[model samples]
Target chain A: MATPLLDKVEDEAAASPYITVTLRIRRFNPEISDEARWEDFSIEIDPKERVLDALHKIKWDVDGSLTFRRSCAHGICGSDAMRINGKNRLACKTLIKDITSFDRKTGATKPITVEAIKGLTVLKDLVVDMEPFFQAYRDVMPFLVTTGNEPTRERLQSAEDRERFDDTTKCILCAACTSSCPVFWNDGQYFGPAAIVNAHRFIFDSRDEAGEQRLEILNDKDGVWRCRTTFNCTDACPRGIEVTKAIQEVKRALITRRF
Target chain B: MSADTTATGSTAAISPVESVSVFDVDHPAPLIEPPRKRTAKTPKATRGNFEMAAWLFMRLSGVVLVVLVIGHLLIQLVLDGGVARIGFAFVAGRWASPWWQTWDLLMLWLAMLHGGNGMRTIINDYAERANTRLWLKGLLYTATVFTILLGTLVIFTFDPNIR
Candidate 1:
């Protein structure tokens, strides 16, 4: 047992030349701290490793108290979305090699900054209260709406009709795009990009009967007008959903009652 | 992981009449938005096309502004000795023509509106507080109106030969 442990240490040292990275994460402990503070932890990681992996190592090996949200580890769940290197992105999706900049003099690792998405209240380290995000999604009524369905068969639709709103259907409810929005950050009540993206999914659906109602809900002053076409949402979206274009299409649909 | 309200406290002690969300999955609360002063500021449903009109106007005016501004520069500066040869006589000569007068007038109005709207958007984005935003926008509109009125007066009342 003692021999294996010593050999394992040797194996790790002999492993591929790993890069040392400093993760400057914003920490907030509601119980202990009155204000949020930045904490740095240096870890040796492979060039291909993700920010999430570094967080896991810090939580598991370095400090068990380190906290963050992660699921599936593959960017599908949209749970690990945070500001990575000053831009909103999925922690699992962003790699350390791409974001890190090295100091030319000493070749030292420049710290990678990570913070919670803006606008929402942060519950603790890197975990925000997502209730407000979910509430905006709910306000848009994100499910397919139909009435008086007597046919037991699946609603038949042409391929062209399905392609109409196909782009918006790719949204995984990640608030990266929404939270990066300046308007949403300014006004808490604004519907934000996420809600508008979800609305576009159903408003363009051929079989949906309640398109008018959803359009009515989004036609208010806070609905589409608040969007300044800043392109922040489009840049922040890890899914490449073309969030700004979807918002424009929604705005056009409001003017001309046809989607 | 999602926010775990369970670890926050016991369920029995929570109040029943609370308006905000009590639970994530069950007994969800409706999103309480800030009360919009819709009556005075943003028009009602019947008049919601105001923003739509403004949006459409920007694109159309931008296309026109491009033509007007480029034509203007080409005649005054690019075609000749750029800015060195231009003088009061040059401006007086151009404004004397009804065609140039109308062109300048249209450009003035359109450019002011476009620039004013652009500034309003910037103010809205940068100004964090409500009162600050309102004050900034109010000043923007006032300056925009003043400039527009003054420029319109100059165009219409210009006498090429004051002597």
Candidate 2:
């Protein structure tokens, strides 16, 4: 009995190779369930495994009907972004051990809480309707517009010119940065950060000829003025884009007419 | 699509490509949305640095307000005595000092403007109807102006020797 107790003590002291953590998941099924509810899952996982892998394990072994969008398990496809521990983040990007939850009583570690990103209508569990997000993106005309002339060759620009808009090009059309914004949470009409980031991509591109038209489009009341520079979008960006800075650049461009 | 094709006739460019311009066959066209409205009355892009100025103002005022508020609370509720020690005489004595008078005045002005601007943001965010936002902001401006004027007058023209 003494030897077994000593072994158990040493195992716990080592933090154990496989640690048990609780996943407090918000569940919703509009057709069946009248209101959303929280469900707890206990799984033993390595600290290095991503939250996406944990979600996969839960779906495969525990609950078959649980629904969420994911493709290209890497961070590139940008399909698995959701609210993790009360902030917008990519499931594939956030590791289980890297994030720790808060305890109300002990003020220490608690269960990992996962919820759907706010501002969009949640269809099933983790799935949110992305139509509104894509609408704002389309409003900015994200594609390069060059009515001047069909380039006999590709539109050529110096490396310096390419670097001007290089940062905004990293956006994978993921709405993580946009949904994390307090302004977006409050007002649906406000063009959120993702759209502005996309606009910045083209507005500063030296090869793009339709900067004036794009600027005019963004000059509406719900445009750049609505951004309060809260920096939540910057924090939530999975691609490491400086979202608030891009918005300020657009604001500066609108003011100075120079991009 | 490339320069190496100069040896071959540029047949791909001449041939009718898939109608991505008109309609994409693989993906359905995104539903057309009515454009966001713009008007000549609103502040145009030519209006330079107004929003930027407001953003800076908020940060500066916030820092100042923090100092003013903490000092005020310490004086009124902690230092000397407590809230029970405060009265009309206390207020009058404080106002008599030019330094205290200036501090109170600054606090009043900054708080009113910050609050009013914040309320304007709230109205912009929540008031669904345009007329509703206009009316709400109008009321907020009126109230802010009224309070600031009254407070400023009080600070400047306080009668320390009232019977």
> Could you estimate the TM-score for every candidate?
0.77, 0.67
**Predictions' DockQ, in order:** 0.11, 0.04
* Clash pairs, model 1 backbone: none
* Tens digits of per-residue lDDT for model 1, A167-208: 998988879998998888776667889999999999999988
Return the top candidate by DockQ: 1
Q: Which residue pairs overlap in candidate 2's backbone?
A: none
Query: What's the true lDDT of residue B25 in model 1?
Result: 34
Docking class of 2: incorrect
lDDT, candidate 1, B8-112, per-residue tens = 112222223335433443433332232231123533444355666666777888999999999988887788788787888988988889998999999999999
* Candidate 2 C-alpha lDDT tens digits along B68-125: 9999999999987788899999999899899999999999999999888888877887
Candidate 1 off by > 4 Å: A1-20, A46-49, A95-108, A228-230, A255-259, B1-47, B78-93, B159-163
Error of 2 at B153 (Å): 12
